[model samples]
Target: MRITNRMLSNNAIRNINRNLENMARAQEQMSSGKRVNRPSDDPIVVARILAFKTSIAANDQYQKNMEDAKGWVDASESALGMATSTLQRARELAVYGANGTMPKESMQALGKEVDQLIDEMKQIANTSYGGRYLFGGSRTTEAPFVDNTGNDKNVKPVIYNGNEANLEWEIAPQVKITVNENGQQIFVDAIDTNTGNKIGIFDLLKKLSNALNSGDYSGVEDTLSQFDQAIDHILDIRASLGAMSNRLEMSLSRLGDTQISLTQTMSKLEDVDLAKATIEYKNYENVYLASLATSAKALQPSLIDYLS
Candidate 1:
């Protein structure tokens, strides 16, 4: 078929448009600093970048959870430490009150201090973090222990109002950890093997108080072993919390490593090298200019151009 002037001009225009499109794409890549601006740029690479981004987001959430759990663990450890100190002080007073030669007035004074320690211990049991009770298990919104010993020191004054449920936090995919201790286990229901009696920390304190106020030397002396046991129990709780804190730190480290790897991989798939992109854009621009020059020269002059 014979080629007409109109067909030659159309062909020249089409070639120039293709060259201009390539230059625009290179310029966009340079400006955005990304190789895969759209899926059409490289569909497989774009899909891989998306998957990496999703994994990074999940790791971010896991890190946040570990941070929150760490706070709870630290708070619990501090409160339990305070409780152990309070118990030690109370035990020292018990040793003093156990003296048979001490007068009833001195015994009463020591009993008053023990009573104060009871109040302090109760406060420790009701410790809170971020306005939530740390020892209350799943019942974090309420106080775990209530005082009922008002006028009668002989009565068991502390009652546990919290449940035995464990509060769990997810620090990784399908990995959950208990973040709270049951108030009932820590504060109440401690069994005394010798007497087959359920003597908790508060029960021991109330008995010691009554013994001191009435100058019962034997009762005061009996509490020494129980006090030692209670102190050991608090230490056990603190040890458990410490172990959890260490595990959370390890989990956070793993998440940080995973995030760094994902970010590097995503950069390889999605980010553009500035130097390479600039060179590519310059090459495309030169080709576009050359195409325009060639098209201008090859297209035959029309009747309209002659008239002008």
Candidate 2:
């Protein structure tokens, strides 16, 4: 079959169009720095890239949660430390108040000091972080320990309003950790392991205050062992908080490692090789230019030549 000038021109134009499209794709990849701009570029690779991006984003949020939990743990630890020291000071006062030779005025003065310590301990129990109580469990917005002692030994006293519940943070895929200690656990319900007595440090303080005021030497002396027991309980809780903090640090490290690995995988899936893309674009551009020149010369010999 004889080839017509129309047919030859149409074929060359079609080849040039395809070459132009290829060059455009290469240029886009070079400028955008992505191998796949649209889904049609390579559907499978695009899908995988999207998945990688989503995983990376979720991992980032988990990392944020880890940071938040760390702050909570630090705040709780500081508060517990303060409470422990306050108890120690009260113990020293108790030792003095327990002496039979102490004058009534001296006992009253110590009683006043113990009362002040009760207020201080209440403040510690109500420690807040980011406007939320650190020891209130889920009732973070409310004060856990309310001081209603009101100088009335016969009536109302300090009370813990919060329940014993754990507030947890999700630090990993399925792993969760406690970030706050409830008031009941730390201040109210601490038990004496040696005697099975459920006397808390706050209750011990109230009893000691009354004993000092009345010059009840026996009652005051009886408090030293209980105070020591309460101190030990606080130490135990503080140790647990420290252990959780260390675990959270490990989770943060693991998250960082996972994020790095995911980032590299995403780059492999979507990031363009500039050197390779630029070379390909030049190759397609040259082919398109050559096709244009060839088509111009081939179509120039028109049907009019045969007629002539």
Q: Provide the global lDDT of candidate 1 against the true structure.
A: 0.89
Local distance difference test scores for all models: 0.89, 0.87
Report the lDDT tens digits of candidate 2 across residue range 51-142: 99989888898999989999999899999999999999999988999899999999999999999998899899999988989988899889
Clashing pairs in 1: none
> Candidate 2, 148: how far from true, in Å?
3.0
- Please give the range of 10 consecutive residues that has the lowest summed lDDT in model 1: 147-156
Model 2 poorest 10 in a row by lDDT: 148-157
Off by over 4 Å in 2: 149-156, 193-197, 305-308
